[model samples]
Target chain A: MLDTYKKYFRFLVKYRGMFVLFVLMLTVLGVINAINPYFYKLFVEALPEKNYQTILNILILYVGVNLLETGIDVIVYLLGDAVILRAARDVRERVFKKIQDLDFAYHMTNSSGSLISVLKRGDLAYFGMFHELNGLYRILVHLILMLVMFGAINGQIAWLMGASFVISAIASKYLLAYNLTTRKAFNKQEDNVSAVIVDNLINYETVKYFGKEVKEQRRLSKAFVLWIKTLWGFANSFRLIDIVIGLISAAGLWVVLHRTFTLYMSDVIQFSDFILILGFVTSF
Target chain B: MLDTYKKYFRFLVKYRGMFVLFVLMLTVLGVINAINPYFYKLFVEALPEKNYQTILNILILYVGVNLLETGIDVIVYLLGDAVILRAARDVRERVFKKIQDLDFAYHMTNSSGSLISVLKRGDLAYFGMFHELNGLYRILVHLILMLVMFGAINGQIAWLMGASFVISAIASKYLLAYNLTTRKAFNKQEDNVSAVIVDNLINYETVKYFGKEVKEQRRLSKAFVLWIKTLWGFANSFRLIDIVIGLISAAGLWVVLHRTFTLYMSDVIQFSDFILILGFVTSF
Candidate 1:
């Protein structure tokens, strides 16, 4: 997997300066995503104080920031498209060329159907990796910015948020990994159903000659029974993940809200700030 | 498509009580999602006035709502999973059985790989449809609840919110359709690349006998060149969609924020309500 990723990254970097700009745009978007909520906090404070000048200034700035952020998002999306598209193309081209360079004996033993599946999945995997892998950088920037902003509000709140984030992240990763394996099972069962359909179709002439269509139907239904069981397993596993994640998020909210209550009661935070903190955490 | 959906829905209804409860859970979750933000507004008002009883009650209810939402979400997810998994299983089994019943001659011409791809994608499509289709019901409930709440606070702001939602929904639909086509093109290009690789591998001996390894590389490279151009087209079209979407969402924000500012200036709403409205719209 590392070797494959290295190969993929090499293609990403082949275009030189474009990839850097793409990364930069993602970072900018992440910062905007993180800090934009603060404007609401400002507006919340300004409105209650009846600070007309401050309110007007903040409204205008807020709209401007939103529009600017939208503009930056377009640029970031474009850069991502360019780098990822180009990289995927390069990788597919290289893979195709390498296939052409392979030994004849290796080709003879391999099934074209599976190879086609590999090729198709590989391109999609490239697309998925480019977004998810590169977005990691953006997520990190957003997270750090959020942590700092939370810390500035109150240390305890920051700790709660950070701990929640960490626990949920870890919990979801495991849950998702389990989901992935179950999904893979679904995929395999799917492939088996496909193989059955394809094999039956390919042998149509023999079946017709033997007049065994009814027998074939019975055979297919047997596959269905197994497929149903597999589907149930897959779906059940997904529900389990959802349940676990939901409970984790709920627990986090309970803890966060409890702490916010204590802090507000003790006058450690202002009403507006309390509102701001709750908004931030809930939105997060 | 309608007929297929009808069949799936029939399967979903086969287990009577679960489906109704699932829909109820989704509706409840939607209302919860919409109303949860208003708690911050309540908190803001309660804190400054030092209404300890109201503050405590609201916090308790707020935490209660969040936990209840999490619980309902789990139930809804589980029911959805069960219904969808059963429905999909029924469909796949029926399809498999039908394949077996087909005239033997009908199967002779179809290749296994293409059939396998169809079966796999069909199963995934079923999974995607179940989640997205059900989620749509939840979204509608959420949107209606939000609009009603906004209208109660301010009509013009409500109109602005409603219009943005409609326009963005339409824009996204059109944009998403175009993206689908471009994605299909990418898939086709991917298939072409796969064919080249698979063909070269299968005919490895012929090339080896002819000592045309370099010639095969050239052939593959030629395919890659076309594939690269197709990929760029696909990527460019996707970026176009993103830009259009960005612009639409930005315009929506601008209109909504402008209306919000006017409402606040006129003192048509409370300061905390202003904070609430801004937070809700922006967070949305």
Candidate 2:
């Protein structure tokens, strides 16, 4: 996976301009989204006073901002798509070239399916890394922005939310480690099922001529059942993790709400501020 | 494409029980999502009354529903993954078997790259068809549900939004058509680049022994330029289409907002209903 990602990174860097543009667009979009909660707060604050003109203006501005963001996002995606596809073509070509130049001993040992699988899975894993990097970056940026905003409004609540976030991160890491093991087991079972299906299909004519349809079907069915059993176990484990995570997030929300309400009752925070926090926590 | 889809359909039906379960899960998930707007409306309505207990209950219920939905979604994805991957494996095996069995004449006529492309792209196109079918079905289901919900709320607003949906659909279709053309051109240029790269890499030692590094680099650079020019053109065209579609969708939203406001002013709808419409309209 690391090697695959390194290769993909090198390829991406070869087209650095497009990637830079993509990152810039994402940054701009994130900034726009981060500011959006404030507009909503402003709109809600003006609503009770029957400020129709202010409401209309806010709505129009919100729509315009959303449109601008979407437009930029679309352009960025198009550019990204072109870059990725072109990169894949180049990589595939390189692999094919490498295979051709490889020694006869290498060809004798490596199955075509293995090579194809490597290329396919490697490309997917590389793409996964790219997406994960971007997602982690975005989350970190948003978290920092939220922290600064919350600290400015109410430090105690921000600190509480921040602590919960740290706990959530640690919990998520543990869950991921556990889940990865189950996922590997599930993947192996799936590979077995695929092996059976492939063997049957490659000799499909022979199976039909030999009147072994039932035999083949039974074999596939057995493999599939095993796959399902393994998957089902994984699913159950995943569900348990999900439930725990959900509860933790809910608990965090409850804490934040309690703090906000208590502060509001004590006249330390306004209702608008409370709504803004709610929006930020939920949206982010 | 049709033949590929038919073959995949047969494969899927051969595993009917799993397919049925997957579809049922998707439908249930869709229904849950369709009903969620109503829940949001209820939550908003309760907000003004400062019903803390109700809000807490709603929040818990929301988290529970989301967790349940996610669990179900994961299972469905696993099921689908098992089927599709197994099917792909079978197809790959069959293609390999064919390669083994094919006459020398056929092999001589086709380059290894072309054959590889056929095997890879054929299976991909098969998967693409399945994806397109699933998308079409989901869109249809969601559209029907939205129309029903919208009609129940306000027929005039529903009709206007429906019209906008039609416009969006037409625009999407046009964009897709244009994309297909550009994609073909881009693919052809990419293939050319690939051929050159493969040729150079496969003869790397020969080139090095003969000190042709500069010559090979120049050749590769020429291919790279061709690919870049084609890609740049493709991206520009795609960007133009995306911008147009984005603008149209924004305009559609404007129309929906106008209709919703008019209905609200006439007391034909409430603020909550308008919010729900906004959610549904802009979700795509």
Predicted candidate 1 versus true structure: per-residue lDDT over A181-234, tens digit per residue: 886776665555555555565466777678887787766677667677777777
Cα displacement (Å) at residue A184, model 2: 8.7
Worst lDDT window (10 residues) for model 1 chain A?
Answer: A110-119
Number of the top lDDT candidate? 1
* Poorest 10 consecutive residues by lDDT, candidate 2 chain B: B111-120
Model 2, position A120, has a per-residue lDDT of 49
TM-score of each: 0.84, 0.76
- Model 2 CA deviation exceeding 4 Å by range: A1-22, A34-39, A78-128, A147-157, A171-284, B1-5, B94-104, B124-142, B189-226, B229-238, B282-284
Error of 2 at A205 (Å): 18
lDDT tens per residue, model 1, B1-284: 47967876787778768888888888888888888768767876788777667777887798788778777877777877767767777777677667656654565554443455456566667878788888788778877887888888888888888898888788878777777787677666555555556556546678778988787777767767767777777777767776776677777777777677777778877777776777676666
Please give, for residues A1-284, the per-residue lDDT of candidate 2 as tens digits. 46755877787887889988888877776677576557536644654554557757766876798799777777667767756766765665566555545665674564433344355444555557666877776787788788888898899989988998999899988887888788778767655654554444345457656766666666766766667677766766776676677667767877886777668656798766866776576566
lDDT of 2 by residue, B214-255 (tens): 676567667777677777767777787768877877787777
* Model 1 misplaced stretches (Cα beyond 4 Å): A1-11, A90-119, A134-137, A180-184, A201-220, B1-21, B89-121, B169-235
